[model samples]
Target: MAIPNEALRKVLMEIEQKSIQSSQQIQLVKAQIAAKKRESRILQLTASEVGVLPSGTAVYEGVGKMFIQTPPSDVMLRLEKEGSDLKNDVTNLEKKLHYLETTYTNSRNSFEQILTRAGGSV
Candidate 1:
């Protein structure tokens, strides 16, 4: 069946809009991954430094809006757990970004094929 010109135009516009949205989402995910990696590195460095601190040294850790005194070992354990969680979040975001890219590519390709069949430029 032949698609009317108006219908084809609407379909193409919707596809373009979705593709743009996906691109933006991918960029946001990339930024999140970068931020997470940076945080993880900072935590690793802090943990290493804390490992060499003298026993019974005072350590203050920030919790939300307040700083609480905590043991160096406890701080190290918290940092390690947070780092692991961030790494896992980054991995999951990467996978989601990959899936979005694939879907966007397929949609764009289909749109292009339809436009070409209709003698359109895009």
Candidate 2:
């Protein structure tokens, strides 16, 4: 079987674009995770310095104020949920990318096989 040059080129181009988009999305997710993780770390340090539970839940008192330090825990939970969603999104993107790349490779291989059979004649 042979694939037309135009079709092959189109698939290859689409594959490249999809891969680039996926990569960019993965990078964005990583950046978001890093930001959230940094905040979590800072929260941990602050809690440690001020005396609080590291499990993100505990009762503590601050200077002239008896607060339950819930902001960090709340933010951490929200960020963690977001991170989980992004990780799942990345996994889906990777699967789509693999499919697209495989399509391109199969088309290119078919073209090559055609060329070989035709003795390199257009």
Best prediction by TM-score: 1
Candidate 1 lands at a TM-score of 0.87
Model 1 worst lDDT run, 10 consecutive residues: 113-122
| Candidate 2 clashing pairs, residues 3+ apart or interchain | none
Q: List the residue pairs that clash in candidate 1.
A: none
Off by over 4 Å in 1: 64-66
Report RMSD (Å) for each prediction in the order shown: 2.0, 7.7
Compared with the true structure, the alpha-carbon lDDT of candidate 1 equals 0.89
| Candidate 2 C-alpha lDDT tens digits along 10-62 | 65566566656655665665566566566656655554553544555553435
Q: Tell me the spans in candidate 2 whose CA falls farther than 4 Å from its real position.
A: 1-70
